[model samples]
Target: MQTIWAPWRITYILGEKEQGCFLCQKARQVEHDEENFVLCRKTHAFVLMNVYPYNNGHLMIAPYAHVSSLTELHHDQLEDMFRLAQLCESVLTLVMQPEGFNIGINLGKVAGAGVEDHLHLHIVPRWNGDTNYMTTIADTRIIPQQLEETCELLRSGFLLEQKER
Candidate 1:
């Protein structure tokens, strides 16, 4: 038999889950912006890098209101969330040069939401053959760039857009 030693997963597998809502906690603490991996912040929403990403430059945009269901959000909230998603798409394109993208929201726990209470839209950049043997056989993904470096690039791109606007 063959084995893949993904020791880093043990932290997620056995680590004590954080209490309360991380999105809410991170949103309120501007002091820990870097530690929280927040790439950009607007009035209604913020973009955060996925701690466990499907690919390089993966991000999630969430409303600061701490709402779960999409219907709970006001029209302005929805508008801002999508605007941020579009901005994220551009930033990812410029920074990662991904051929495509997969963007969506997983509503509840049964719907595959890791953090079910706080609604978030995932922005996963896709490339040709981004999935391969590691995914099918070993259940692992290969991300080419460091999270912080990708965050910096995307953050810079995001800020540049704001400045130009």
Candidate 2:
């Protein structure tokens, strides 16, 4: 497998355990939603806008627990993760109206997980013709929307729906 190692990932790998856990930290700091690009927080997981996305409105839903493998998670955690993923898809569709999405988890380090300490599902909003010559020819992916705007749209949509419930 071809590994793409970025300089920032080193921090995740070498971080102290006393920091508790990164995923848990995000879960705990609920008030930092806007700054953190966190759209919604469910019982077992949360959805956040991807700061660096393959496309606009790209997001990720992850378990609150800091587990590396899917099998290591409890049934409730797995269920909630999928539930959040489903809701994330709905919110993205409602707000961005994308043609489709790329939703799944990269299980391990070799499989392109930037945070190997936690398992998260990437919900990447996609569109027809979104991939262009830039990616193939220029080796670059263009995201048309800002992360803050995407997060605001998703967060408002999610909060509105929550109010309905």
Candidate 3:
């Protein structure tokens, strides 16, 4: 069997997991936005890159409130989250030029929510032939760009986008 060298994953595998909601932690740590991979912050929600992404430009829009489901969010929070989703799509389109996008929220653990307690929307950019043998056969998804670089690009993109508004 051919081995894939993904040394970065070792940090996540061996690192001590932090307690409490990571999204909430990130939300509170505004000064650490770059380290947290936060691209944009709305009034009630924020957009950040997925550290374990399904695709290179994968992003998550999450409310500041620690709510398990959408029903728990105030209308303003829910609206802000969706607006952040639009911002994610716009910035990803400008920077990555993806042909398509997959945007949704996984409401529960059984429905594929990794962080089941925090309500978040995922925006995964897609291109033709993005899925290949590596994913279908080896069950490994390849992300082409480094997270820091992507974060910087998207952060700039979001800034430019906000400036135009």
State each model's CA lDDT, in order: 0.88, 0.79, 0.91
Predicted structure 2, TM vs. truth:
0.82
Better of 2 and 3 by lDDT: 3
Over 4 Å off in model 2, which ranges? 1-22
Encode model 3's per-residue lDDT on 1-165: one tens digit a residue.
778888778988999997899999999999999998988888999999999999998999889999999889999998998888877888999999999999999989899999998988999999999999999988898888788899889988998989987
Q: TM-score for every candidate vs. truth?
A: 0.90, 0.82, 0.96
> What is candidate 1's lDDT per residue for 9-89, written digit by digit as tens?
787899888789999988898888987899888889999999899988889999999999999999998998999998999
lDDT of 2: 0.79
- Candidate 2, residues 41-120, lDDT tens digits: the string is 77888887766678888788888887899999999999999988778877788888988889888987899988888888
Q: Which residue pairs in model 3 clash with each other?
A: none
Top candidate on lDDT is 3
TM-score of 3: 0.96
lDDT of 2 at 107: 81
